[model samples]
Target: MMKTILLIVTNIEQYASGHLKTGLWLSELTHIYHAAKEKGWKITIASPKGGNTPIDPESLKPLVLDGISKSYYENPVFMNELAQTKSLDMVKNDSFDCIYLAGGHATMYDFPDNTTLQEILRDQYESNKMVAAICHGVGGLLNVRLSDGEYMIKGKAVTGFDWFEETLARRKNEVPFNLEAALKERNVHYRKAFIPMTSNVVVDGSLITGQNPFSSKEMAKVVVSELEKQAFM
Candidate 1:
C-alpha cells in the first residue's frame, strides 16, 4: 500500500503585534513534500482552519531560499495547494501513515492550543504511526496528550527551534513564548545542535523532529528512511 502523509500548517499570517507577516515556512513543507514524493508516497496539506495559508516573507528571501523551495514558490500548482488546504475537521486522522507539523513563527500562535490538531496528533500517535515536526512546527506537539493523559512527547528525545536560534533570527523577543523551554517543561529529553542554525535531527522510535529550518531536508530523509523500514517490516 502507498503511504500517505498529513501535513499540518498554521493559518495565522502575522505576529501578535500585527506588524510582521508570518505563516508557513516554505522550505519546511517543500523539503518534506519532495522527499516523500520521491518515494512515491501521497501527501496532503491541511491547516487548523481550511483556507489559504500565508507564507513567511522571510522564507522567501533570496539568501535563504533554496533551489527546491524556490521552484515550488514559482510553481502555480504547488502555490495553489497552500491557498486551498483542507481544514483539520475535514481530514480523517486514521488514513495517514504519518502526520507532520510544518513550522513558521506563525505556528507559535496557532499550533499549540488547537483542539482538533491535538486530537489528530493524539490519534495518530496512540495508533503507533509516525509523528514528525521541524523548527517551530514542533510547537504543535506541546499540548498533545495520549489517552493516559501524558504529553505524547514526554520522555521522548526531541528537538526544535532553540531559544538561541530565535536570538540568532532576531525574534527572541518577538515570539509569543520560548519553544525550547516549553518542550523541556514537558519533560522531553530535548536536544539541539551545538552550532546554531545547523542541521540536527532526533528520532525516538516513531517521533522524529528537526531542530531548525536548515534541518528540514535531513529530517525528511530520516522520516522516509524510517517509514521505508517500517513498511517492509
Candidate 2:
C-alpha cells in the first residue's frame, strides 16, 4: 500500500497589520511534497477553512524561491491543491501515515487556536502516527493536547522558527507572539540551528520538526526514512 501524508496549510492571507502580505511559504510545502512524491506516497493538502489558501509573496522572491518550489508554482495541477483545500472537518475521519504542517508567517495568526486542527493532531499523535511541522507551521502543534490532557510536545525535543530568525526577518514585533518562547512554555526541549537560517531538524519518537524553511527537505527525508524503516519491520 502507498503511504499517505496529510499536509495541513494555513488559510490566513496576511498578517495582523493588514498591510504586510503573508501566507503559505512555498518551499515549506513543495520541498516536502516533492520528497514524499519521490517515494510514491499519496499526499493530500488541507487547511482550517477548506478553500483558497494563499501563498506568501515574500517566498516568491528571486533570492528566496528555489528551483523546485518555482517549478511547483508553475505547475497548474500542484497549485490547484492550494486553490481547493479541504476543511479540517472534511478529513477528520481519514487515516494517514503522517501529518505535516507547512509554514509561513500567516500560520502564526491562525494555526494555534483552531480546535479542529488540535483534534486532528491529537488523533494522529496519540495513535503513534508521524506528526511533522516546519517553521511557523509549528504553531499548529502548540495547542495540541493528548487525551490525557498533556501537551503533545511536552518534554519532547523539537525545533521550529526561533526568535532570532524572526528578528532577522524583521517581523519580530509584527508577529503576535514569540514562537520559541511559546514552545518552551509548553515544556518542550526546543532546539534550533546554531548559525540560524540553516537546516535543523529534530526527531523525538514519532514527532518530527524543522527549524525553518531551509530545514524542510531534511525534515521530509527523515519522515520518509522512518516510514521506510517501519515498512520493513
Candidate 3:
C-alpha cells in the first residue's frame, strides 16, 4: 500500500488586525505534494472547517510564484481538492503515515486552539508517524500534548517565523501572540536563521519545522527524506 500524508491548511482571513491569509503557501504544499507523489505516496488536504480554501494574494506575486506553485493554482483538479478539503472530524486518526502543516499568517487564528487538530497531532506523535510543520503552521503544534501529558515540542529544538521576521513583515503587532516568546516560555529549544526571514529548517526527531515561507521546500524535502528512511528501517 502506498503511504499517505495529510496536509492541513489555514481557514482564517485576518489573524490579529491585518490580513490573516488563508490556505497553504502554494510552494509549501506543491513541494511536498510532488515529492510524495514521486515516492507513490497519496496526499490529502484538510482544513479546520473544510471547503473553499482562500489563497493569499501576496503569495501569488510573480517573484514568489514558481512554476509548480503557479500550476497548482491554475489546476482545476488541485483547486477542487483544496476547495473540498476533508474535515478533521471525519478523518481517522491512524489513516495517514505522516502529517504536514503548511503555513500562512492566517494560521495563527485557527491552527492554535483547535482541539481536533491537537488530537490529530497527539495521535500522530504517539504513533511515531512523521509530523512536520512550516512557517506559521508551526503554531498548530503549540498546544498539542502527548498521551503522557507532556508538551510535544517541549525541549525539542524547533524553528518557525521569528519575532524579528514578523517585525520586518510589519505584522508584529497583528499576530495574536508572539510565537517565539510563547515557545521560549514553554521551554522549547528555539533556533532561527542568522538573518531575518531566511530559510531555516530544523529536524528534531520526527518533528520537523521550517522557519518561514522560504524554507517550505527544504522542509518538505527533509520530511520526505525522513519518511523514506523510516520506511526502510
The TM-scores, one per candidate, come to 0.98, 0.98, 0.94
Give per-residue CA lDDT, model 3, range 92-170, as digits (tens).
5547888999888788888889999999999998888888998889999999999889899999999988998888878
RMSD of each: 0.9, 0.8, 1.6
Q: What is the lDDT of residue 50 in candidate 1?
A: 86
lDDT of 1 by residue, 91-188 (tens): 95448999999999999998999999999999998889999999999999999999999999999999999998898899876899999999999999
Please tell me which predicted candidate would have the highest lDDT against the true structure: 1
- TM-score between candidate 3 and the true structure: 0.94
Ranking by lDDT: 1, 2, 3
Query: What local lDDT score does residue 174 receive in model 3, on the 0 to 100 scale?
Result: 75
Note the Cα lDDT for every prediction shown: 0.93, 0.92, 0.84
